[model samples]
Target: MPRARGSGASAAAGGGGAGAGHGGGGRLSGAGPGGQKSARGTALPACLSVSAGCRSSARACREGGGRGLGRAVLPWPPLVASVGAGGGGGTRGWADTESVGKKRCVCLLTGAWLNGVMGRRLGKNKGALNELFSKAAGMLACIIRESAALTRDVLEQHFNDLKGTLKKLLDERLMSLLQEVDAIEQESIKPLDECQKLIEHGVSTADDLLREGESAVHGDVGQQNEKLCIFTKKALHIQLDSLPEVPSLVDVPCLSAQLDDCLLTILKNQIFRHGTVASRPPVQLEEFVEKPGGILVRWCKVDEDFIPQDYRLQYRKGTATHFEDVYIGSETEFVVLHIDPNVDYQFRVCARRDGRQEWSPWSIPQIGSTTLVPHEWTTGLEGYSLSSRRNIALRNDAQSCGVLYSKAPTYFCGQTLTFRIETVGQPDRRDSLGVCVEQQNGCDSLQRDKAVCISTNGAVFVNGKEMTNQLPAVTSGSTVTFDMEVVHLGTSSNEGGNFKLRVTISSNNREVVFDWVLDQCCGSLYFGCSFSYPGWKVLVF
Candidate 1:
């Protein structure tokens, strides 16, 4: 081995070291938290890396010394030991092992004086991530607030416009949606509230601990140990690795809003459609409004003199040839419930005669759709075609790259887009085989100038610039999901909320979450991804 100088740079540069040995201020290898050797301490290993530098950083990293924002796991390994263990670049005839050991010992002593000065700078980035997370939660709250308000205004304005057209009907539906909006806002903000309280309490506690430690340091020696105990216990309880889940768009999804506009428009044209009397059909599926769970269908009589004994409501599922009875009674308004979200359903109504007479004819078929938006991939590149109602994207040309983009009903707050890797044609042909983003569907590759993506090697790139966050690479047959929500609205007053999604990508059960904020404003965002090689099929939802 070469007798490299104890340059202090070799051991502390990275935190992937195996161990550290006796250097300056070095106690036993297994020193306790009190900086004292343990009763059963084992001797430190002799073979240490010669290239290690800056012992203070390395020591801080190993000890997890600093306290800020909150505690977190060391992203990499410890840096104190295993510097030149593999030996410097040279062929070694190990005839004089003792001499080499002696030289390494001398180098350790030379680097010992840098104990406090060097390693303190080690792993300076430890707590930065947690700090950013806390701050981002705050910022995201602001964005959600603005977006929710805008959404409320939009909804209110539409109903208010219809106030004169159908006062009773409009008012009832408007009030229901408004109430629901309030509930959604409250539920979404609940976790944020709890998180805020916890952070504030922690800050106050940390302040108290700091003051107590400072005073104790300056005052009585006997009190220091007690303070340490309190500090250690308190610090250990501040959990990391996860954040409280705040409500987003996907939680407790209900039937999506589907309006039978054609039917409603016809009803609106008839000035005398609503009356106490009945017609051939006896009832009309006149108006329908969206409820959180399903649509509310309302009908009325056509003539004041004619009366019906009772009414009946029936519905048919998507694309079926026959209609099934759902509700049967005299009620004019019925709330359809327990239906699949986002799917199309047909509803019809009729009435029975007054005196044990036969039932009236079925009303015109009214088409209604649910409100809940299912995950889907709408568009893709030339070599890719969408199947399963645009929910799956298949790459037919294995020789070329495949790219796909998600459609509307974009990821709102707390919504997730998942991709099942049904076919891993040739992941080895490309550096990235899974999810990515592009400015628009026009981009041919994920490495575009406006794209934000992670390479298969786990490097993050934004507009071609590499970032500090190193995500995990994807594997074959892995399920890749992207959870996105609105984090900010555009600067303009009328512009819709811009999406800067905080992403967490996981595959094969190894998940790592990191924030990759995309700066684009389109109210809703289109998710895009590109695969370098072909023969890959993705089922998106």
Candidate 2:
């Protein structure tokens, strides 16, 4: 009647008890050995239910009794019991003992089994929770990294655009400042130039007077007095009383300081204001050829925010050192007259804002030329009859044809030459009028065999060969007008150096137009008329 073997023994040996194993359930059940009902329910193990002394005594007694056996079971706490399978009045007591033992075994085994299952489940859940947290953390970290990268790229691109804009604005402002400085420099030197010219003139005149007085000393006495009086009167006529005072160079420092201050003020007001940047200059400043030695220049503003209140136009000749102001008012265009014909000129323009003292930078300089005025005509023939009126009349001779040519040559680019020829009598095909490019000394006679010419019949002859057959006829008493323009092609040695000549001839409602590409003659070209028929008079205007 040893104690029944059950899972309680294994659980107690592994440091587990009913109360500790079943999540701290302190009760134990007692049932019969054959699974009969128990008098009491599950009961707590002795180790957990009794005091320390009682647990030690019980363990000692169980060890002593079960020494011979290989396994030992600790005693349980005394509790009520149920009956065993052997039922009788006398055997009831023994039956109850067996039942008590069986019930304790069953309770211990159930507690241990439940504890093992719960432990495994808890371990699995712990691992799953840890994995979930790790995954969530990793996802959050990835999102943060991606967001940071995007933010950095966006900020970098924004800064780059801002930098480019700032650079553009700065360049525009610098160009404007440079233009203003150039204008100021030119204006400042004008008075000095005028004063120098006057001084030079006075010196030249004084030297002439001294030389005249010295020469008069050797003449006859009466003649000397008369010559002296004449020289004295000539000197008196040159009035120097109103000469402008020369500016002192010592004042340059003071003037420069004032200029710097003025420029600083303008910069602050126009360019360096709180929230403004630079702006572009006005749009294209165009120039057109005006009749009679003049040019018409015009411009338009593109920036609407910067409306100009006034415009200033300045121009200079090819050999000039300073630009002279041509117009300074609100007009967008101006006519600059008195320009020398066939001379190269450059023009610039600036605009002033309303209530602002500083003028905008000058526009890019435009280069152009005035219309050419033909030089006096020269001829080599002696028997050729000529008449000098407002226009020149050349009477043809049969023995010697007359060839009249200009003395000076004009530029091939941007030049227009116009003239009219009226025939008095019937003219043959041999009588021609056009422009030619030949050696200066080779143009002595009407040599149609050695030069290029456009005939009155509108045929173009190149080097004495007919190049074009389109001819406009000129009848007797009819006037033929010719207009020629020379255009530059480019700057290459073979192409840029060459020029294209456009010719238009009109007479009696008939007109002929043609263009010819000419090689670089590099010398002077002459505009002239040639005639061979006698009694045929041609008047050139």
Q: TM-score for each prediction?
A: 0.29, 0.29
Tell me how far the alpha carbon of residue 6 in candidate 2 is from the true structure, in angstroms, after superposition.
Answer: 99
User: Each candidate: what lDDT?
Assistant: 0.46, 0.47
The segments of candidate 2 whose C-alpha lies over 4 angstroms from its true place after superposition are: 1-374, 387-391, 396-398, 410-413, 439-451, 476-499, 521-524, 539-541
Off by over 4 Å in 1: 1-370, 398-402, 428-442, 455-460, 466-472, 486-500, 518-522
Whose lDDT is greatest here? 2
Question: Per-residue lDDT of 1-541 in model 2, one digit per residue for the tens?
Answer: 1111111112122222111111011122211111111223333222211111223322332343221111111122221111111112221111111111112111222233223422233354445434433553454355446546765776678668877997999799879877877777888888888888988888787788878878787789989999888888977887645566887788532233223468668766864443322323443353233323455454555355777888888888875799888888887656565656666677777788889887775654555444434234554445355554223555655464456665444413222233445444555666666666753343433335435565656666655677645556655665554455544465663444556666655555565666656666333456666665655555443
lDDT of 1: 0.46
Per-prediction backbone clash count: 33, 8
Considering summed lDDT, which 10 consecutive residues are worst modelled in model 1? 70-79
Candidate of highest TM-score? 1
